[model samples]
Target: MAVVAVSAGIMPDGYGSDRCWLNYDRGFIWSFLGPVCCILGINAVLFIIILILLRTALSQMQHGPAHDKLIKMVVFKTLVQSVIVGLPWILGFFTRSSQALDVVFHVLNSQQGTFIFLLHCVLNEEVRKQFRSCCRRMTNKE
Candidate 1:
C-alpha cells in the first residue's frame, strides 16, 4: 500500500513509503493530529466505561466459579471485531489516492465513525450482560 501511494505520487518526496498508513504525512501535525487525537479520546472514554462494567461484573460474581473464562472470551471477541473493522482503514492509509489529502481525511473520519459504532455495540453487550445478571440475582432472591 505504501508502495502504491508512493508510486502514485501522493506522498511527498523523501518520506519513507514503508511507514504504516497512519504514520504517513503525520508531520503535518495540525491537520491529521487533531482528528486522530479526538478519535482516540473518544475511544478511551468508551474503553473506560467497558472496564468499569467488566469490573462490576467480576465483583458481583460468586467466588465459587471463576469468571475469567467468560471475561477472556469477551475480550477476545472485542479484539477480533476491532481488528476486522480497522484493517480496511489501515490498508487505505498506506495506499494513496489521486484525490487530495482531504479525501483521505474524510475516509479516515468515516472509518473512525464506524469503529466508534462497533465499540459502542461491544460495550453495550457488556452492560446488557451485567443487567441480566442483576435481574437474575434479584429474581432468585425473591
Candidate 2:
C-alpha cells in the first residue's frame, strides 16, 4: 500500500512538490502539529487523568467484586481507547522515515473504529448478551 501510494504520486516525497497545507514549510502546524497534538496528545493525557481519578475513587469507594470488576473494565476500556484513538497519530511523525512504517501507520490509523468495535462488541459481555438474546429471539420465531 505504501509503495502503491508512492508510485501513484499519492504520498508526498517531502520535496514540497504538491504544495498544500501538508507541505512541511507551507503549513506544518495546520497539517500535522495541530491535529497530532490536539487529538493524540490530549487524548493520552485525558485517559491518564481518568485512570488516576478512577484509582483514587476506587480507594475511597467500598471494596466489592462489582466495584472491582467495573473499575477493571473502565481501566481496560480507557487504555484501549487511548491507544486506538491517540497513539497511531504519533506514527505520523515517522511516516516520512520508512515506507514500511508509513504503511503501518496508515493501516493502524484507518482501523480505529474496527478496533473499537472488536473491543466493545466481540469482547464485551454486555454486547454478547444482546447478541445471544437476538439469536434466541430469531430461533424462537423460526
Model 2 lDDT per residue over 104-134, tens place: 8889989999999998899899999999999
Whose TM-score is greatest here? 2
RMSD score of candidate 1 (Å): 12.1
List ranges where model 1 is wrong by over 4 Å. Answer: 1-37, 64-66, 97-142
Cα deviation of 104, candidate 1, in Å: 15
> Could you say which candidate leads in lDDT?
2
Model 2, position 93, has a per-residue lDDT of 70
Model 2 scores a C-alpha lDDT of 0.74
Q: What TM value does model 2 have?
A: 0.74
lDDT of each: 0.58, 0.74
